[model samples]
Target: MTQSADEGFTTRQVHAGSDARAARPRALPIYMTAGFPFDGFDDAAAHFDQGDGFGYTRTGNPTVDAVERKIASLEGGAQALLVASGQAAVTVVLLGLVSAGEHIVCATHIYEGTRGLILDNLARLNIEVDFVDDVNDVAEWESKIRPTTRVLFAESIANARNDLLDIASIARVADGHGIPLVVDNTFATPYLLRPIEHGAAIVVHSASKFLAGQGSVLGGVIIDDGRFDAVRSGALYPHLTGTGRLGGSSLAERHGGLARIAYLRETVAPRLGPTPSPLNAFLVGQGLETLSLRVQRQSENALIVAEWLSTRPEVASVDYVGLPSHPHHALAGRYLARGNGSVFTFTLRGGIDEARSFVEALRVITHMTHLGDVRSLILHPGTTSHVRRTPEEREAHGVLPGTLRLSIGIEDSADLIADLSRGLDASHPPLETVEAVREESGALDVVVAA
Candidate 1:
């Protein structure tokens, strides 16, 4: 009983691949085997020579395949591939698209981990990556394009700040240049916004985050919308377009619109060894079963907390798009139809010293570097995520010395606000500092009298 395409998101997330087995179990069974036995002689020959079935777990697995199908269905993608972690997904996806000497245009407002990957790791491969200052400006995205550029990548909702990218407008820019638009949908998840439906050619997610719900096991997913014409743009994507390395058919001809994902599945992921363990896949599947319920409640809680923080004297500004005070709230309205997402940044009134006090004073919210968890998380971006970035560069991306990023979770709104208020009260300078300054002034007057 394959799920109907007309099924709602909530329905699809839970029931998409539930009935694939002959006898359905209450929970999806994990095929925990590393290798499946071959039928012998001719069967093994067919499997090895023709790429017929799953001979090795590294190439594919039943548990991973089922989870991939559910994610693809949720994102309205032609196909999906699950990887070991979010970094692995981004690495394999970019490697599958661009070889050395090619270039990529990226948006500046992205996760700091990804920024490091693009700036340091990819640069080592000689694959140039240029970042656009204003991702909202189509012109800025276009201006970064070169003859060798192959992909335009941005986040659907940035992790550091809840920045919204104009997916359709940027997708149009990539279309004009005959390249694919790769969007990181890790923060928004599919419940909030599906980037592929808005004209993005490919969508990626760090399933370890909200998709995992509890931050249990690490996972990543790549969804191909199957719209990019890799075959048509042979000159730009010769690797995907040229004759197959094994001498049969090119990836472009074999998979058509989904050549990029096929290239990853067959070539990149296998060799890179980013295979997801069946147990991890099962954990992530468990998270997906309740994605809508968790994400919806999390968004509501985030909005309530963001609004309350904005009114406090200890807060200077908030970066959540749900707040009208945000500079990109209108863009949020146009793109984020469901909710603006739960992760955002806020600036403490004092500098790094205040941020330290606030983090130390936190009782309910955890002060960890992770986000999109079941428990609320807080971190000072300047000292943590964006620490590698120079002070000027960090400031350019709104990571001020006083700025703190929050990933609101499914906690009670009142509890979260109360905890934040406690942090605020502790963030201000201690009364002893004022008295110490006055005592120093009195000493100077006594010296003059002497």
Candidate 2:
């Protein structure tokens, strides 16, 4: 059963897609099977012809379906599709919407994987991509939109830089040109900011992160706001409005507001075969129950840590939008009123050598590439996520030699601060050297050692 919008967020997260009258199970039961048995030939024919029941796991599963519905409700979207991974979700949505010779206007700051997907894979397929550096500038976004452009893509809050995209403003720009706005809301989850509510046509998530709070499983979801009218925008999406494998009826005619989801479910996902396991889906569903609690605590911990880092003499800058010093703090407050997200980056005054010492010196924080885990995770983006890009390209995205990205978790603020202090101490020169420098300056009475 689908939950209504009137229900509280936590209530909907717990109750959405749950059937109280059917099995009487408090937890959503995982349908662990490749295929469901048909009662008879008529049932099989109906299931195959009209897509009545779950014919195969590749197409759909009750467990995956429950998670999809839950995420869709949380995101305030008409429908959602669960894929194997976040990359798969992005791939499925773009493939479903665009084709060869088309183009997509994207924000310059985004995940490295997505950047690679657009620049390497999609470009190889003859699809062009133009990146706008300043997403906040309406003119910059509007200027890049060509007639072939079908989508405007950006992250709600970008990964390492903490640049907050003005969702409503960019959505307006997309709306003006009849293009759909697709936002990757992984950093600022639905609890922080629902892109659909801000006029975005579609929302995507790497459910592996905050959605599955423990970072135990990998999953992704694509949510459709149901505002992109394929029939109205038929020129841009001919595949959706035109006839295809679904007999004579078009997807728009068959599913109405749910045309994109129907098309993905019936054709794109199955054909691409990025099937999510039922067990992983069930785990992700369990994670969704505490989404708000975990994210809130993580955000709080992050803000405290960001403040502490700002005061440190060894730190050059903190890239958290929660901090007043950050350039996008005001914009973050406008769009992300719940809390500035936990995942952000900071840089040290010393270069890679200092960064290596800091990362290795941490006691509680885990050195890892993953984010949004229950345990605080940290990594250097220059040599890790952004290694493939040239030095100039890396600098353009703010991946400097001294830069390190941190994903704050639901840990005690004091303990996290102590661990960070330990790392900072290790990264800086010895106290003896500081004392010697103060003595040499003959200002030991006034100058405090680092």
Candidate 3:
């Protein structure tokens, strides 16, 4: 079916990018050839000039195109580009935008991968990046924007911590500056939230995560709203506004509102060689076929897990936005109406030793660094993911000594609770402390009057 904007997410997920008018295979076929055959010299010359038809896999592929359509449809985007990895997607976007001596204002609540890419990797290219301490503070966001600031970047739902980004507010800030607001919507997949509808100019996803559902294929996707006008935005994006290389028309002049994404597809992604394999693209398509189901299940299971953990004596705090106790629950209610994502971090009652015991005692939940899988995964962020961050930086970001991040999956809640029970038991306080707490507390839950 050629997708309609009116179609529900699940319907579109299953049928988008398919042409019902054409007789084709029910399943998406992998166009595995390195290059497509041309009719003759004239046809080849025409293909080179016309630029729509697929000529080479590195620049374009049928299987990859189909998957890109599905993703763009799902994300409510004008176009999508599938790349090699999530990091590649960010790098491609950066290459498309900022040049040397420019600046990017980003949120500190983002994943470590992006943080490193901006602070460490991008710095090498002389692209300055600054992080805002609070994503909810529009004033703070505005304060960081400079004349050279090219974009505003943040996560819809931050990884590990589950902090919510006030996308509309930040987008307003970006719009005020005549710049685009780029949101990493990996955690809160399009099944849950479409950042574009909330005013974000662009959305990117680590398709390897929830979009793939399984911990298999390594892929990334970038989606644009196709509303950004470089001409209207003044001179912030000269790459899109000025004459193109070889003295051709500028990107915006050539593609109108779709200039940025077109640049990424035609120049940044292909030139950088971040194109995915046909088989990998096919794998991503299969994952997309069940995107809603897997993410919904994970969201539901996550709420259950969060509720159970909150009442545990071994757990000091749960950083899930779904919980009313979260500092930003109101933001979650306003933005993530469907369900809070599954990835969240919580701290143990004790320090790193207790967290280690809790992690090592887990049986059903795998202790791994990866997330957005069919199986529940656990990891200690302080030591595993953010070990490079200074002690003050980690603590400032709420990564306590005993913090453990959980990416809940489609497992039975009871079984997950059972595995966590063993971990809690191993990490439980000493006998004297338990006795003192029991004597002092009299409530069944946190009320502590039982």
lDDT on C-alpha atoms for all candidate structures: 0.88, 0.90, 0.89
List where candidate 1 sits over 4 angstroms from the true fold.
1-24, 429-450
Q: lDDT at 84 for candidate 2?
A: 90
| Model 3: lDDT of residue 193 | 94
For lDDT, the strongest prediction is 2
lDDT score for residue 277 of model 1 = 96
Candidate 3 residues lying further than 4 Å off, grouped into runs, are 1-23, 429-450
Q: How good is model 1 by TM-score?
A: 0.90
Best by TM-score: 2
RMSD of each: 8.9, 9.5, 10.5
For model 3, name the residue pairs that clash. Answer: 442-449, 442-450, 443-448, 443-449, 443-450
lDDT for each residue of candidate 1 in 357-420, tens digit (9 for 90 to 100)? 8999999999997888999999888988889889998888888989998989988899999999
In candidate 2 the C-alpha lDDT for residue 447 amounts to 65
Q: Report the C-alpha lDDT of model 2 over 1-450, residue by residue, as the tens digit.
A: 689999999999987975546556899999888987778899999988888878899988999999999999999999999999999999998888889999999999999899889999999989999999986989999999999999899999996688999999999999988878999999999999999999999999998989988978999899999866765687788888888864598988878878877888888999999999999999999999999999999999999999999998898999899999888888876888889999989999989999999999999999987988888999999999999889998888878999999999988999999999999888897789888887878775556653
Q: How far off is residue 231 in model 1, in Å?
A: 4.4
lDDT of 2: 0.90
TM-score of 2: 0.91
Q: How big is the positional error of residue 138 in model 1, measured in Å on the Cα after superposition? A: 0.8
